[model samples]
Target: MGRQRPPRLPPRKMTGSLPTVILAGCGYGAIDALRALKGQARVIAINPYPYIVNSGMSTRLLSGRFSLDLVRIPLLEHIHTNGAEYVQGRVTQIQPEVQTLTVQTELGRRRLAYDYLLVNVGRELRTIAGIHHAFTIRPAEQLLAAQTWIRDCWRRAAQGDPTPGLLTFVVAGGGCTGTELMGELYDLCQEMSATTGIPLTQARWVLINRNRYLATGIAVEKEGQNNRFSRCIETGIRRLGVEIWAECQVKAFGPEQVWLEDGRELLAQTRLWAGGLQVPQWLSECGLPVGPEGSLIVDECLRVKGSERILAMGDCADFAWGSQTRRLPKIGVYAVRQGPIAAQNLLRLIRGQPLIPYRPQATAFVCVTVGNRIAVAKKGWFIWRGYWATVLKNLFDWLYMRNLKPVRWREFFY
Candidate 1:
């Protein structure tokens, strides 16, 4: 089947005298841009509270490590550390014709203009209705709701309740977040069992993906990485004794059960959509040049088409992926790398200098954690595993966050 391209967008004017850079979406990508432009422009960063409902960090949070609040990657705090403005609200509209943005905050409807704009609104999983029991957190409020439900589950488990209830979890995507959630949940159940004595096997752990083989088309040496992830799910379920139904497509949901297309109906408590993210509807509604994924079409220098004054970085921008491909993943790494390049380009454009073409790197820094214990590294032909890989993964996660927004090095040692 041919790929369904994004609708064509009408062009806008290229003139503006605004003294602001409206950086939207405070996820990993947006934060990078915010950090880079700390004192250059009056930046306004927007985002929901560090996200909790995406099910990306379910295991770490559900393990009772101070709940989901502690797990959130706060957008405001990260930016404030580098001296920037933050608006905690939803961006309801963007009007590029006048180079203005409308936001709905607690204070009420507010408007702002931009000299340069970088949209980094991360992505949201596709959530279905009538699946309230399996609530997924995308926004800040949803994470609070999910956390409340978890507390209730813990209460019931502690009471030795054996009733089949609607507190089960089924992750419906097997990408990085899905795999990590499944493995982490397995560990959570084990840890919870020791605390509540409810038998870890009582909780169900399901990876409901459409893919036949896990991580298909993954590199050969990285087979160990893929297998380690698959085995983490398999051995995790075996040792913890949980249930998993792979290659199942969810058709609909009942009050206490979820229906699969293969004539299987499983009693489920919650159905997490780890499947994928779509572009924000508002962007398309703006009639700008957006790619199929709702990513703004930009040149090598990350300038939005038709408007040399406008630029987008991170998830919202559709820049080339690597040295070969013309599309990139919506990963934090891309945003982090692009932040410096985008800033350099924007600065050059501001100073009336030659714009540098963004050269996407050939190799990516990948550290896929199968579960909490193990992770595998892959870059070009390099693939290695075991405790060393996990160590490297931790170091990478730490250094990635630190290097992007450098913190006091003494803190790490102290």
Candidate 2:
């Protein structure tokens, strides 16, 4: 058998006839660009996840309201619609001079050559020691994991196994995500304990953040000072029987407790970290100009600094306007708006036309939900809270998903 070994097969090679445009990541920005580039060239979309999860609806996933399928859009469906190739892999390296990308696939490593590249790998959650003790409301997997954990804890509670901290849920970070998570979780616990003999009142929910004031809520930061909006959010959280610990830093997460910097310990059966988001390390380590947060530094025109063939948008991009000291907020709207501009600029580049600069909208609106049918909207100094705010938030989310999942399946065989 050893002497009768067969000949090895040769590596497959790509024909050099088509110009390739590689869109890395299936985030809001990347998807938009992929749609725009349809029929223009041979597009290759690469993403590690098989589905594109809508972050806006992630909170609802924790509750029993939305199923995983409701929030996930298949990446392959989009690729098929645009007549593009979809590679389920992560980008390992980007060689600018050679215009090639090193991708790590399930089978093995593969090389992709591209005439243009759009990097929108997005950001990852910040973490601390014993982070495994906590759940993060990030991509679909994290949200699903947290959902499972919550259900398991509730089941344990129903079985009279409510150990110390087993019924207590602690949410670290007072940012928009953290605040909303605590609110949504409060509702979930209430629902789970409604008829299970485990009264919701027995369940404890806590929020800890180092920031004296939350960035977005009923209150807006005025001139770097905490104002009434902060109090409003605190009042809402308190009304839900949730405790708030401002200016408190999380030192370490124990198996069943959270240790604070001030030597205080909290019993948390389930801990959720909505602390903050940081750009992926690969962005900075790949020899590109990156900000302190590891996000790619992009110019006004949404082009990556020091390169015209490369561009970055969304949470992965650090873009500033007139004020170089402050960067644009990493929100969905900014990325949505940047998509068209990036597509236009890219098309212009291909046509040897001048690129258009992007001007960020000054006053961005942010809506943070506290509970079902209750939310807060902040726009500059204007702050509003009511059912209408929640409705508006849902509307925005719906509009975004509607634009993303387009049905354009005009196939053309190569």
Candidate 3:
């Protein structure tokens, strides 16, 4: 006897008579927007994960100073406490014409309708050939996996494994993430060497960057066609016994080999990629106008072009300043600054009032932490590097996390 399959259930509608405002991603900007629109509208926050990871402190987590619990903010609890609904699912499709969203959840596929939508899903790591075999810096959770891999390598070295590359680590990309990661990895290796009675020289670390300079994102000053900031950072990193390969690109990654564009191959058991980022394909597929990098094109008021009901911020949004073709850098600080503006604009949109434009700062401040409690900071033509700079960076990160969750003072230290 053949049994009939279970009947397919209809899509569950997730709205009432009240106007709903959907927060597409629970990122920095979305969190602030949720707080602003708490009592003004029926706010619903949707994300695949139940928590949001703090990327600023991700390297601290990798270096074993911060715990996983400390870096993750309880998004579900925060939303429910603020009188908003939380949906644990991935937004598969967005039908702007119908004001409907297709979400894939555990129960089944559900269709949600909203009067307004705010997107800040953030960007995903750009992939290269054989990227699957290497660790990436997006999603923030992969840093934990890399931490575990490092511990395993230390364990093998402690047991006198004669295999080469067991203690070798390679980081591709010299951007903020890759440089910070390399610094933390250097500190981690030093700690492991001290604990395992292995000489630190036995551990190898290499940082590869396609650009001619490291930390290219930082504000640069040209002194006879030379970037002063990059030169300073390069000297600091080299002093830490780490190798820096400039003007190099990683072609592919294997189990223990990294192939370079110049036909050079390097063997390393642990490989990490933090090269670049791109928006999710589904964002462009949803019929919204996107820029070159697949980010939604937002106007001066943070509203999507040609749509009043849609707004976007963060790395998922492409916003250009007045009369400028260059878009703002994809950084958390800019997203934080855009949150309140997005929320206020949403309120004004609902009340049929005039929307305010978001003015991004011309010169943004940036700080990159090196190992041994040292950091480099730059803004416009000013540059600073020292322990005090590290202190300032830590203070900023601590305040940011403390605002999101109740964090203990001890969590910031090892």
Which candidate number would show the highest lDDT if scored against the true structure? 3
> What C-alpha lDDT does candidate 3 achieve relative to the native structure?
0.82
User: Per-residue lDDT of 97-199 in model 3, one digit per residue for the tens?
Assistant: 9998988899998899988899878877788999987888866768788888898899898998877899999999998889989888888888888888889
User: Tens-digit lDDT track for model 2 on 1-414?
Assistant: 012212222322346554578887778766666677787768899999777877767777776556677667777787888788999998878888788888899999999998778887777778788888888777667867887788788888899894887888998999878888887888788778875768877788889988887644322135532355665666677788888888999998988899999999988789998888887777777787988777888887777888867888889998876633457778777787888888776665554566778777766777777875588776777778887887777776666666656422221000
The collision pairs in model 2 are 218-229, 219-229
Clashing pairs in 1: 53-137, 54-137, 134-270, 134-271, 166-269, 168-269, 321-327
Predict model 2's lDDT versus the native: 0.75
Stretches off by above 4 angstroms in model 1 are: 1-18, 29-32, 35-39, 50-59, 65-83, 140-160, 165-168, 198-203, 215-244, 321-326, 403-414
How many residue pairs of model 3 clash at the backbone? 0
136-188 per-residue lDDT for model 1 (tens digits)? 53543454555456556756868866657534767666666666556555555
- Stretches of model 3 off by over 4 angstroms after superposition: 1-16, 218-226
Give all candidate RMSDs, comma-separated.
Answer: 6.0, 10.4, 8.8
Clashes of 2: 2
After TM-score superposition, the amount by which residue 238's alpha carbon in candidate 3 deviates from its true location, in angstroms, is 1.3
Once all C-alphas are superposed, what RMSD does model 1 give against the true structure?
Answer: 6.0
Give TM-scores for every candidate, taking all chains together and pairing residue i with residue i.
0.77, 0.87, 0.91
Angstrom error of the Cα, residue 172, model 1: value is 2.3
lDDT of 1 at 62: 37
RMSD of 2: 10.4
